[model samples]
Target: MTWVGPSACTLPTVEQPLRVAEFDALFAGAVQGVAPPGPRN
Candidate 1:
């Protein structure tokens, strides 16, 4: 499924819900005390 060059390539949608447990563990382990990126003004 290559989006080859020529006309501007349309990127496919990645419509998967990420697994929360994996991200939760990673966030707790490596990202504690770090504020997430602030909302856009």
Candidate 2:
């Protein structure tokens, strides 16, 4: 069986925990300055 979703966004080995505020900050930062690779073109 093959499946892909948000859960597949990362690898299974490393674990980088993030706080809600930290995540919100990162998301906001991305929107403000950093340009993500974004969806496939």
Clashes found in each candidate (C-alpha, N, C closer than 3 A): 0, 0
Could you tell me the lDDT of residue 2 within candidate 2? 22
Q: In candidate 2, what are the lDDT values of residues 1-41, reduced to their tens digit?
A: 22335465574434323343466677777775756697997
All candidates' lDDT scores? 0.49, 0.53
lDDT of 1 by residue, 1-41 (tens): 33234344343434222333455667788874856798899
Tell me, by TM-score, which candidate is best. Answer: 1
Which numbered prediction scores highest in lDDT against the true structure? 2
TM-score per candidate: 0.34, 0.31
Stretches of candidate 2 exceeding 4 Å from the true structure: 1-18, 32-41
C-alpha root-mean-square deviation, candidate 1: 11.1
